[model samples]
Target: MIFLMVELMLGVLISVAFISLLERKILSLGQSRKGPNKALFNGIGQPFSDILKLFSKEYFKFSVVSMKFYYFPPLFMIILSFLSCLIFPVVGGFLNMLDELIIYYLCLISVSSYIVIYMGWLSFSKYSLLGSYRGASMIISYEVFLFLLILLMLIYLLSKGQLFNFLTFQSVSGLVLLIYFFYLMFMGVMGLVSELNRSPIDLLEGESELVSGFNTEYLGFMFSLIFMSEYLMVIMGVLFLSGVLVWFSLLGYFVCSLIIVMVVFFRAVYPRIRYDMLMVIFWEIILPFALMFFF
Candidate 1:
């Protein structure tokens, strides 16, 4: 059991590293700039080098910050992010044994929002507080759509006698079903981008305005934990959508890669939207469309 858990953690960590490298490469190409070319194998080693650099730095905390709150939220966030990966159905993997995968996922994500807010508040910085406020608002705005979408999916699946299994969608077939799944995937991508605080949607970490946002005060190993957790959540979100759309196949992996590329592509090409506009996009446009499906 322990070995399996360790294996899962290593796999997630390695994948996170490569995804970071991939994002850098893609962003560089998008901007017509050289990126990470000095590292081993034409920048293949850049992510690991970054990991080392981060861990090697001396740890410090603000005098106003509580040690427990400063340390615990990042660690807890990462652990929850890791646990969410267990919902991915892996062959012979003991960790994916859970039932009602969607419910489990929703619970984890809902909890993570609070952790993000807490982590920010714990930093004792005005920038962090502002970022946390933005983060909470953004999350709350989009999370309702996420919940409704999932509920719609759960209802459709139950109507079809499918008991909330990721693998069950593979056997079901229809134009309506395909269109519905695609809609969910679309909203899932948007929600995940917002939830994970990725580019454009990353108002919580708006560098220009908030100076790294909620994590402004975090550095070194502490920052790395938060960083790793965010990337892991990205992977988990992509995989979840892939499972919904394609199940666990070679094609599913391809789809997952494509989604990751799309995420990086958005980061490369788009500018962050205003927070009010972000709220409008979700509440006015996305939410109504989601409601149409639900009804």
Candidate 2:
């Protein structure tokens, strides 16, 4: 078990590194520019080089009140993101008890949400505070839709007396349910992206207004940890939707790859939206639609 866990963690780290490179390459192509081809193997080693750059820098203390304030949040963010990934069964080699989906998701959301609040509160800047507030609220708002979608899936799974089983579509109703499930899953993915503070909804990091938002005071290795945490969250999101899309075969792989591509496409194509507009989309639009689906 320990070996499997270690292997999974290593795999996640390597995948995340490559994913970072892929995102840069995709975005660069979209903007008609070359990206990160200077490193080893035509920039295949870019993530490692970037990590080395961050680690070589001196970790400086800002106007933080205590050592705890300076260190705890980023460490917790990294740890929580790690934990979220560890709990999910990403690789086929390891076996996890399939019944803990609810518990796992609840913990993932709670810890992820707290990390944002922790960063904002610890930073001791009004901008961080405000960004944290917005981030927390936005996350909580979208969380309702996410939870509803998950609950609907759980209900279906429970009725079938199976957990995380997506291949048993043996009827017309089942087919319809599968379609609806993916529809809700897409919405869930959007909510997850919002929680991760990706582009198009990155109001928390509104540089024009918040000056990098909740992470304004973070620098060097500290900032790298935060950045890695964000990447891990993105991985978690892919693992999640892919897990749901798993049906009979290795479709999860295709689903997972598609999601990463879609996220990069979104970043490349979309502009950051207003925070209020985001809130409206979540609360006034998504919530009601999700509730209708739930019923």
Candidate 3:
């Protein structure tokens, strides 16, 4: 168990590094620029170098910030992000050990939401506070749709007596079912992307307005922790969706990579949508489409 857990953590860290590199490269290509080419193997070593540089930097905290609150939120954020991976059913059947996977996941998300608000408030900065407010609103907007979709999947799995049995779920298919599955997958991916505050919907870090969002005051190791936690969540989201959409482990990996690439593509091609338009799209369009699935 210990070995598996260690392996999982290592895999997650390495994956996050490469995902960062991939995103930088793709975004650079989109802008007609070469990104991270200075590092070894055509910038393959860039992420690691960046991580090392972040850790080597001097850490600083403002005098007005409460030491406990200021320090704890980033740690909590990263820890919760790590715990979110437990439901993935990867390595040594860790997920099987948990009976209430969905409940656990939802709980983690709820707690992380509070942590985001706390991180912003602890900074005692107007920019951070505003970002937190935007982050909270964006999270709330998509979380309902995400929850409904997950609940729908859970109900289907329960009715089929195949809860957590993703392989079996993928095997039972038809044209209608395939189309429906793809639709849900699309919705799920968008929800995950929005939930993670990725590009196009990244209102939290709207540099034009929020000035680095909730982590504006964070620096050095602290900032890196928050940064890493975001990417880790990205990997977790991709893997979870892949498990639901594909059967074989190898195929699931391919699907995960494909999804990550798709996310990077969106980040490169699309400009951030306006905040009101974001809320309207979710509340009026996406939410209604998701609700129709229940009927």
lDDT of each: 0.80, 0.74, 0.80
* Candidate 2: 10-residue stretch with minimal lDDT: 166-175
RMSD in angstroms, all models?
2.5, 3.5, 2.6
Q: Please, what are the lDDT tens digits per residue for candidate 2 over residues 61-154? A: 5655576666889888888877776545444423244445456656776677778887888888899999988877786687777777667766
Look at candidate 3 and tell me the lDDT of residue 43.
91
Off by over 4 Å in 1: 91-97, 169-184, 244-248
Q: In model 3, which runs have C-alpha deviations exceeding 4 angstroms?
A: 159-179, 244-248
Which is the winner by lDDT between candidate 1 and candidate 2? 1
Residue 83 of candidate 2: its Cα lDDT? Answer: 77
* Model 2 C-alpha lDDT versus the unseen true structure: 0.74
User: Which has the better lDDT: candidate 2, or candidate 3?
Assistant: 3
Against the hidden reference, what TM-scores do the models get? 0.91, 0.88, 0.91
lDDT of 3 by residue, 106-179 (tens): 78877877788888888999999998888778777999988887777766767777746543333332112335
For model 3, the run of ten residues with the poorest summed lDDT: 169-178
Name the TM-score of candidate 2.
Answer: 0.88
lDDT of 1 by residue, 1-295 (tens): 6666777678889999999999998998988998898889898899999999999999875788789878998899899988886765543455354556567788898899888899888888999899989877877798998788667766777897776565553233222333556765666678878888898899988999999998899899989999999999998877766664445356666777888898888899999999899988899998988888755
